[model samples]
Target: MTHILMIPGSLRAASSSRATARALAARLPQGTTCTTADPGVLPHYNADVTDDAEVAAFIEEVRKAHGVIFVTPEYNYSVPGVLKNAIDWASRPAYESVFKGKPCLVVTTSGGALGGVRAQAHLKYILNGMLAVIYPCKEIIVTMANTKVEDGILKDDTVLDFAEEALAGFVATCG
Candidate 1:
């Protein structure tokens, strides 16, 4: 079974990005278990506390993950600070980090016309520095995401189809 770790770029209770992440998680292939990262409990990246139990546990989860999916939102044409900080925390220990060689999938949602293209670009570059293998397929950009989901479920078939296809391809490559 493929173990996928999903990270959403927002901390809001009604975050559209989180909703989209949950939607994608529901569509992952059978035998795949998708879990979202708990960045709320994570303190900002601090090398001094690198050995903290929470940090260690989170690192362990990333080390065991077969793939990672980032469901992010655009914040001033870049990724939110918290998500970037989380990535930095996970990419420590230089070339021996858990993110090394892990397959990464990036998707973005926003209320803007360009979705989150700029943030996606920044995230791709960061993953490159981490030596992660990122999927080179159609980027998933869900614009005006507030309207795409309702009652905690994706209400758009087109969006769901795209997510399913991307997830299927991701699983095939990583599995």
Candidate 2:
């Protein structure tokens, strides 16, 4: 069975990013299980700290997953600091980390028309720098995402359909 680890960039419970992740997880095909990681529980990244249980567990989650899905909202045209901190913690030993060669799919959401496109680009670049194999597909950007969610779940059929297709393709490439 293919197992995917979803990382939502926002810390808010009602955030579009989390809603997107929740929506996508519910649509994953049979035989494919998913788990969402909460980056908020992690501490600030410190190069000297090696005994952080949260950090270690987070890294292990990345290491064990067949692939990773990043659901994020644009923050000043870039990924949020919390998401970046989680990445920094998992990225260890320089070029050889748990993220190295891991399959990754990025989905960006926004309240604006641009749909967090800039943040998507930034995240792809960051993942590339870690030697992660980014899924090669048309970008998944959900515009006006704030209104698409209701009761903590994304309810847009149009966006959900397209995202489900992209996610299926992403799953096909997972190792």
Candidate 3:
């Protein structure tokens, strides 16, 4: 079974990004499990605090996962500050961190027309710097996300199909 760690870029209680993440989690292949990374426990990134228990545990989770999936929303044409902070924590030791060599997939959601394309590009670059092998194909970008998710579920058949196809592609590529 593939164990995927999902990280949402937004922390809002009703975040469209989180809804999309939940939707993807539900549509993953049988025997694959998805778990969200808890960002609340993560403090601001500081090299001196690398050994913090919460950070250590988060790193361990990333190391144990077979792959990672990021559900991101654009914030001022860039990835959210919290999400970036978490990544910064995991990108330590200069290429020897938990993200190194890990397979990753990025999914962006937005209420705007572009569907967080800028944030996705920024995330791809950041993952590159961390030596993470991001999947090239099977990219998911949910535009007008507000219309796709309802009450924490993705209700649109079109969006669901796209997510399912992208996830299947990721699984096939990794396994």
Candidate 4:
């Protein structure tokens, strides 16, 4: 079975990013399992406490997954602090980090028209620095998140189609 780890950037109740990640997971081929990693449960970045329960669980999730999907909300034109902290935790031991050679995709959502594009770029850079093999498919940015998602579901077919197309490429790439 192909296991995919989805990490949502926002922890708000009924979050659009979380909904989008779930919808994306639904589009994957049969037999592909998608699990979400909640950043809210994680502690702030601290190299000295890598073995903490939360960090340990997060690391295990990353190490076991076949690929990772990062669903993030933009904060000041960058990745949210919570999500970045998860990245920092997974990306340890330099070249030997679990992020090394791991397949990851960044999907950003925002209330604005840009759809957190800047944040996506920033995350890609950080992932690259960690030697993560980011998927080269078209970026999926769900803009106007407030309208696109309702009741914890992505309502726009266009945006979901974009996610579908992107995931197809991701699936192929991983397989």
lDDT leader: 2
Q: Is 3 or 4 the stronger prediction by TM-score?
A: 4
Query: Mind giving the per-residue lDDT tens digits that candidate 2 earns over 63-163?
Result: 99999999999999999999999999998877899999999999999999999999999999999999999997867888999999899998999888887
Reference-based lDDT, each prediction: 0.87, 0.92, 0.87, 0.88
Model 2 C-alpha RMSD to native: 0.8
Off by over 4 Å in 1: none
TM per candidate comes to 0.95, 0.98, 0.95, 0.96
Give one digit per residue, the lDDT tens place, for model 1 in 1-175: 8999998898988888998888889899999998888776678888887467777777887888899999999999899998988888889888779989999999998877787999999999999999999997878988898877787655667888977988899988775
Task: Give the Å error, residue 90, model 4.
Answer: 0.8
Over 4 Å off, model 4? none
Off by over 4 Å in 2: none
List of clashing residue pairs for candidate 1: none
What is candidate 4's CA lDDT for residue 63? 94
lDDT tens readout by residue for model 3, 78-161: 999999998988888888888888989999989999999999999999999999989886678889998777888767778778
Number of the top TM-score candidate: 2
RMSD (Cα, Å) for all candidates, in order, is 1.1, 0.8, 1.2, 1.1
